[model samples]
Target: METIRYGPEPSQLAELTRPSGRPKGVVVVIHGGFWRSRYDLSLGRPLAASLAAEGWAAWNVEYRRVGNGGGWPGTFDDIAAAIDALADVDDLDTGSVLTLGHSAGGHLAVWAAGRARLAGPPWGRPRVAVTGAVSQAGVLDLAAAHDANLGTGAVQDFMGGSRDDRYRLADPAAMIPLDVPVRCIHGTEDDVVPLSQSTGYVERAVRAGADAELTEVAGDHFVLIDPASAAWARTLQILTALG
Candidate 1:
């Protein structure tokens, strides 16, 4: 694994793992912890290594969480910068970049995929485009998640309080029909993040003529990220098929 700095902040960096030879593509592994500082990038290391073993380059990213220097635009800024930073890395085929994120990270993954649809700073003109995405029990609908308070006010905290028009830019559910493909994987018994999050988003996306689908597996929220779990196996299969 190699450490690359996209910005001066300690958290504004990524850990990159490469396959033994040329990689088939790059997968950005985003971790989940309700977008809090306590949950760091270490959560993504296992997935990164696993992707490398499968002959794909994995970019495990870290960004400022709420307790740190992240929230609203700051967190969004870090994600965009981290992905754009890949342009500087050699021997990488950024053209086919994809994202695999769990929980809060899942929201960010889908959100990032629709960056180009947004119109301005913190949201538009992505330097690196997301070709595809996989959301593992993500909090996809910001408005819905806010109302349900799924993360115990996590959505409010991440968005820095109440919803407004600008938030439409942040909600993946609102930004349907993304140019890239999106696959949502949710655990049937996930209570941490309700299965409806993925199901609802996919339903809305399909209605909007977007390339989206959902797959339900047996287990809880964390099972999807466990490298050894059958859920993860299904995830790998989807990733391969998507590519």
Candidate 2:
């Protein structure tokens, strides 16, 4: 594994590599855990390493989360910086870079992809575009997530505020007009984020005319992160299609 800091605050981004004659691709993974400190990108090591073992370079990213300097524009900013920094790493196929995020990180993945593919005020425009994006059981609708309020005050804390925060920074349902290809995978038994989150996102994305695909399998939220779980295989298929 390798590490890099995208922010001045020592926030880290990590990667796991498998020896391949030529890299198949690079998948940048952002962890979920509702953007809290307790849920570091390190927890997703199994997923990252699994991706590597399955033949892709896995870049696991950790940025400022709640209780640190993260939240709102700062989180988005750091994500962009990390993606940009990832451009310099040696083993990756630059044109084949993909962002795969779980839970809250899924929300981050969509936000980051939108910014990288579209030009607008909220974001300063991406330095470069990525190949694709994957969101696994993400909080796509900020207002909805805040309303449901999963994991105690975890959502609010990670967002650092009211529903408006979700609207501005974390609402991929509203932001899915993005040009980049996006594929979402969610477990049906996801007691945490419900399948509606992914379904609603896909519906809205279709309405927006963006290229999107969503799949539902049998399991819970964390299954996506488990190397031994079925959700990981679905994730692998999605990541490969983008390549």
Candidate 3:
């Protein structure tokens, strides 16, 4: 694993794990911790290592969380920089970049994929585009999550306040028809994040003519991130098929 800095900030870094042979593509692994500072990039390390073993260059990214220097556009900016930084990595196949994010990271993964749709946004244009995405029990619907208070006001904290006009740009659910294929995998028994997050997002995406689908497995929220769990195995299969 090689550590690279996309920005001068301590959190504006990412760990790159490359396969021995030429990589099929790059997979940006974004961790999920309700977008809080307590949850760092470690949550993505295992998935990054696993992707490397499967012949994909894994870019495990770290961005400022709420408690840190991240909130609203700041967090979004870091994600954009980290992904665009892939352009500087030699021998990496930037043509087919995909995203794998769990929970809050899942939201970022899908949101980053749709950055192309944002017009005159604060994050700016995307260089390395996302071709596909896999959301592991992600908080796809910001409004729904906010209304339910799923993360105990996590959505509010992430947005930095109540759901306002900014939600049109910030919420993954609102940024539908991502144009790229997306597969949302959720645990049926997920207590941390309801299964509806993925299901509702997929439903909206499909209705909007995007290639999206939902898969439900039996496990809690964390099972999807556990490499040893069947849920993770299924996630790997989904990612392999997408790749």
lDDT of 2 by residue, 1-243 (tens): 767666568665555554345667778789988887766877778887788777887778888887677876677877888787766766566677788899899988888888743446546466546778899998787777778887677667766777763475457766768788889899998998888888988888888888998988889898888888778887888888887
Q: List the residue pairs that clash in candidate 3.
A: none
Question: Model 2 segments beyond 4 Å from truth?
Answer: 16-18, 117-122
Residue 25 error, candidate 2, Å: 1.6
Q: Give the runs in model 1 whose Cα sits over 4 Å from its true position.
A: none
Query: Which candidate, 2 or 3, has the higher lDDT?
Result: 3
Query: Which clashing pairs does model 1 show?
Result: none
Global lDDT scores for all candidate models: 0.92, 0.78, 0.91
**Candidate number of the best lDDT:** 1
After superposition, candidate 3 runs with Cα above 4 Å error: none
Lowest lDDT sum, 10 consecutive residues, model 1, at: 120-129
lDDT of 1 by residue, 1-243 (tens): 999999999899999999999888889999999999999999999899889999889999999999998979788889889999999998788988999999999999998899999887766988888999999999899899999987799989999989998578888988988999999999999989999999999998999899999999999999999999999989989889877
